[model samples]
Target: MRRHVAEFPDARVVLNMRSGSWALKLPFLQEVVGHSLRSIYLVRDPRAWIYLMLYNSKPSLYSLKNIPQHLSLIFKDDAVREGCPSVAPEFKTIQSVLSRSEANPALVLAHLWLAHTAAVLRVNEGLPEESYLQVRFEDVVNFPQETAETIHTFLGVPLSPAALNQLLFTTSTNLYNLMYEGDISPTNINMWRQNMPRKDIRLIEDVCGGVMKRLGYTRLAS
Candidate 1:
């Protein structure tokens, strides 16, 4: 931090946070990126995040909390739509691929996503709006240009129109879906719902019922 401050005295650093920070009490942030911090928090729906983590479980920060433990704030209706939105891919083709979870993945994923989201809201609480910024991960996936533009404005950086165009049509992230079978997971950009067993879906619904309905994730149309 001392060197960074000395090198770029007026440089305002923006931390691009996704998940794990809020869920794990942010000890990781304090250790790695806390000093000399101007923060922009990008949050995702814990439920949608569940889908991502289930397939892309990065040990770096993903923690699975199967059961809900009491926290400071009990979530109510109209949860704040932080800057980043979490995406739940309801695309029909993708669902048919990730249908197999060795264990009860639906409920597990739901719990993890919701619990973590709650944690982030708590961590971001009381943080001055300027010092901390919140965004939804989903908004980034579906509307990259708009999302990127928002990010650009937030950080006061120049985002070229060409760069935004490239992000919009990219198929790289589709690899996450089993849309291409030989692949481990479907890549139709999310079909977790279509492929998951009915029971598992029900389980997820039970655990994350409120969020699902509120966020319109209960059912998908082809």
Candidate 2:
């Protein structure tokens, strides 16, 4: 969007970014962006964020092209698809990991999304008041029109009626599960309790728990 906006002489920045982008704090972002830009800092429950990441990790659900070229090993697993024509020969690596991991893919995703973004939050603890006003995805999903109204008002931009309608109708579907009809009941929320490798989950917790709890993760009772 920034690049698209840049083409016009009167173009202004309309940043649709995460609350934890930490751009304002980093000199690189601010130095490059300067006063010529404005942004909409969208945020969501770290849990939901992580869960979506895990769900998107499945080869069936995502395009490998979306994966950062630099994070090749990370997404190169069988989970990453070569493309629509067909998967490449080397796709088995991700396939095996998907098959071998004991963790429920959805739960693993929730935990990672939560842990990673919570860590990002902790990393940028004291940003200036005007830098970003965080908005939760949960709240927006529940009251989308109100959120849109708030955003339009804040940025002084007109969010078209069509845009508002699109927001209201977007359906939530689980990417990993077979295509079917059902609510994304959080019944699987803690499936990690049984299936995830103890060491990895422990590493996740130790690395992100302090901030995770601050953002409302339920810690296992000691």
Candidate 3:
């Protein structure tokens, strides 16, 4: 980041990183950028987050079989020494859960979510309010323009009328392909309700219910 800023002094750099990757690097990044750094934390409802993890065509790092390797990569001695909070306890929790012969994918994923979210929260707690903003994924999909405006405002950047229109056009065009039958709608917000199995819903809630409630996502499964 310092190299990038040195090379392009006037440029605004936007980094899109998963929570785990972001947490691991945040300490070093803060040292380089100091008060100039701003973070926009995008959080999704755990149910939807887990549903996508299970069904997405691409392999996920949070998969029960894959998570140990993923965690090793992030928490390796060199990486952790960069001033990142020690997630050793979370790492052990995942290792112990994964060792269970009866552990199912959904249950493993719920634990992975807890660890990753906790890692990010631990790092983010040190950031000043002006340096951090949390945006819900549902709001971005349901109200693209408003979300864009909110993001720009948080970053202290200007959102011109023409730029805003272009942003919405691009977002809609990109999102169209991800929707069922290429239909653009906010229905994706509750997509897990229709496609995820009831047992899986209950399982995710059972594991993630406390944090889910704190994030203001109501549990749908009894």
Off by over 4 Å in 3: 1-20, 56-88, 166-175, 178-184
Error of 3 at 75 (Å): 7.8
Backbone clashes for every candidate come to 24, 7, 0
Comparing 1 and 2 by TM-score, which wins? 1
Q: Would you list the C-alpha lDDT of every candidate in the order shown?
A: 0.48, 0.47, 0.71
Ranking by lDDT: 3, 1, 2
Q: What TM-score does candidate 2 get on C-alpha atoms?
A: 0.45
Q: What residue pairs are clashing in model 3?
A: none
Tens digits of per-residue lDDT, candidate 2, 45-94, equal: 44334333433245423233333232234444435445522333333233
On TM-score, the candidate that comes out on top is 3
Candidate no. 1 TM-score: 0.52
Q: What TM-score should be assigned to candidate 3?
A: 0.75
What lDDT would candidate 1 get against the real structure?
A: 0.48
**Candidate 3, position 85, lDDT:** 50
82-139, model 1: which lDDT tens digit per residue? 8532322221212232243433445545655555554555554655454455566556
